[model samples]
Structure formats: C-alpha cells, structure tokens
Target: MQPLACRSCGNTVLVAKSSLAHTSVQWADSSRCVEFALAGSLTERAVVSGCTALRASIEDAVRAGRIEVPAE
Candidate 1:
C-alpha cells in the first residue's frame, strides 16, 4: 500500500474500501484503515483539522518506534 499524504488534512490516511467497524478513532495501522470521506452531516474543514492531528500523532509514533503495524 502506497502511503498518501493528504495535502488538505496533512494526513497519511489509509485508502481502502471498508466499514467503520474496521476503522478507529486513531488509525495507527494503515492496513486497517479505509479512505476518508466527508460525511454530509459534517463540515469539510472540521474533518481536515482532525485528520491533521491524527497524522501528526501517527508520525510521532513512527519517530518513537512504538508502532507495531504489520507490513502491507
């Protein structure tokens, strides 16, 4: 899986066809994450900001070598 850097959200959210059950508040594992979509009930900017923070956290995990995600 090719990691994608979201320019608008500044996140590397995993892109796949999946359901909410397979995802989480924090997608530490790319293999488990599906693509991000803006729900009709939410604003685009809010999602973008949240995703930015999420990406930063994931980056932090990588820097600390604490993430144990399997190879995709």
Candidate 2:
C-alpha cells in the first residue's frame, strides 16, 4: 500500500492492486476532507477532476479511519 502524491494537485493518492486486472485508487482532498475512488487498467493512466463533493466525502471517511479495503 504505497502512497502517491499527485504532481498537479499535490493530493495524496493510495494505490492497491488485486487479482483483478485493474488498479484502484483512493485520493484525498483537504478542503472538504474526503477520499475519492478511481479505478482503471494498470497499463493506462487515470485522471480525476471536477467531483469535489464526492471526493471530499470519501476523504472524510478516510480521515475518520472508516475506509476498508477488502482482502484480495
């Protein structure tokens, strides 16, 4: 579970891989305090923007230590 920082936005991003072919991401937003999910192929790059509310909700859950990543 290595953490990544977005170069453009400086957001904290979490990356995890499973048996499935896609990679999952958890991105953090400080303004609204939430984390957002972005999933896509491992071979391609993923970009997320313009979903502030949703991202903030997720970040809030993560900040409260409520997010659960299921076992692969």
Best by TM-score: 2
TM-score on alpha carbons, each prediction: 0.30, 0.34
Model 2 lDDT per residue over 1-72, tens place:
546454335566675544234346664543332222342332222343434543454455445544444456
RMSD in Å for all candidates: 11.2, 11.8
Off by over 4 Å in 1: 1-50, 69-72
Model 1 lDDT tens row, 3-28 = 44544455454433233222234344
Candidate 2, 66: how far from true, in Å?
A: 26
State the C-alpha lDDT per candidate.
Answer: 0.42, 0.46
Best by lDDT: 2
lDDT of 1: 0.42
Please report, as a residue range, the 10-residue window in candidate 1 with the lowest summed lDDT: 15-24
